[model samples]
Target: MPTASVKLAVIIVSYCNVDDVDRCLKSLGRSDWDHFEVFICENGGEAAYGKLLTALVGADRTLQRASDGASALDRPHKRLASVTKCRFQNSAIVVRLGLATENLGYGGGVNAWLEPLLGVLGWDSVLVLNPDTEVERRSLSELIAKSAEGFGMVGGSLVFDSAPDKIINYGLHWSRTTGRVIAIGRNAPVGSAPSSDDLARIDAISGACVLATRSFVEDVGLMAEDYFLYMEDLDWGRRRGKYRIGFASKALIRHVGGTTIGSAVAPEKRSHLSIYLSARNSILFARRFAGWRWICHFGVGLLFAARYVLKGSLSAGRIALAGLLDGAKGKTGRPDVAPRPH
Candidate 1:
């Protein structure tokens, strides 16, 4: 059911990078495509920057404020009593300028806005771009064309910030041996073309620069919200047997990768949530999709964890272990502040 009028809804979820969001919108304004609407999902910021973003992008830009809102999860209201008792009384001093609600990781933030973009706005395709990214003029056109080939998901070439020709990630690849996923073309001396065949058929693509058709959304469905920050892309990519996922190599964007978490955030801490989710969700994903293959996958994860600890990223190992514990406890939400970056 292809529509004659294809409207793309581009969503950028903003946490702390107001400058990055401003640059992203400027890049989007230079896009060659015409039929699109952009929205910013704001989770934990003052309304001032959000208002400034809306002014730059357009007055029609939708801003979904997560602050000052009730928990999306249903815990007993009494449980929040303690968190509120201390913070609520003093909240009047800074609540309006600070985060009103809890942080919804990448999946939750994007889904919050995208669900409405699809259900209410009747958009035919949805594009999820990171705030820290700036797009090339040709990127949008290339993504739309690749997506038209019946793939439920599509990703573009991502370069490091401002190094347009230098590739950051051409796409993502999964390692069976380590149960690890690596960004292809990571810091690879810039401007080498990726495999055309690989681009045409992929296991998964990064959510960083991806587009999904309406049917893709209705069928494969929105990103799994349980993953607060990471692995949703892998989870989405694992669904490829039931859906199509491809790469638009011609499309290009730049990422200031690891903005929220520092490069030194320790592999264990940096990847704690990732390790836990990769472990638990890999099992969950395999149970639903991969079958016996996950046993082998868990073995690979152990080896990978060992490699991280051996490399002196004990924090990452700690985080990964914590993630596993949380997953085992069936926890679903963002971890607090990530140990303040050492």
Candidate 2:
């Protein structure tokens, strides 16, 4: 197939963040990339589907609702969602929406949204994007080109939207010993390219923007859902069989990250969901791949939890500690905790 003729499925999973989704669609207004389809899931299940539908199709114009196929999206939950089809604002970008019956965490939501079409022949590459980010005009095109170079998976250059010229990270470094992740190019100036040393250390790409070819998914399977929210990208990276990871430095992306699960940008205001998941998944991930070093991994994880207590974030501290304990006991799925004010 001509690389340009390859169909791309752009997947965005949202959690009732209608405004964020709206802004994301608006960013694509200037994009000239055609032959792509945008698939969305309102995992929030608060009728954000209706709002997103209005946002994409516009109130003045109505488009036919394409049967979303979420009713058949398989999981134990067997979630059924209302799906819609529309054209994005001022662009040829096509969109499909899924109103989830329940709140599936980030990883699960992606599976729920894209599961129905995973085997369909319409697309050869899939770009999983977070709704809280805006793609630069050439980002997708750049990502597509990089995939054509034979990388099964590719990640775009992500920058903090708050400071557009500062790098968030080119990719991520997940430590097996500590079971923690550090961004490879974090806080560096945006224009500088990642050095060979930096690229060598990147074990995983940020889930904020990922492009995977059909073969990669068929080989590795859908992204792991065991962690639910955090650490899934690293988990996926660890499972990639023989495929190489690629970076599209010119595919600049602006990310306002951690929008769902109330993961705030400020560490002090960390949400219970964020703290618990991050702390717990560190243990889960380590157990799967860290071998006998899992003990040291948990120790480092506890120290991380201690920082929250030292900083006087009592709720977050408690949540993190509980998460560490739960993860050690082989607990999975959502934690049994109430939402704390972040």
- For all candidates, the clash counts are 11, 0
TM for candidate 1 is 0.73
State the TM-score for model 2: 0.91
Cα lDDT tens digits for candidate 2, 148-237: 999988997799988999989888888876777989988988777678888778887889999999888888988887787888888887
User: Relative to the unseen true structure, what is the Cα RMSD of model 2?
Assistant: 3.1
Give lDDT per model, in order. Answer: 0.61, 0.77
Pairs in clash, predicted candidate 2: none
Q: Where is model 1 more than 4 Å wrong at Cα?
A: 1-4, 45-101, 185-193, 263-296, 307-313, 328-330, 336-339
Worst lDDT window (10 residues) for model 2?
68-77
lDDT of 1 by residue, 132-238 (tens): 88888988887888778877788777887756667777667765444456777666644455676645435577878788888777777778877676667777777
Candidate 2 Cα misplacement greater than 4 A, ranges: 59-78, 89-92
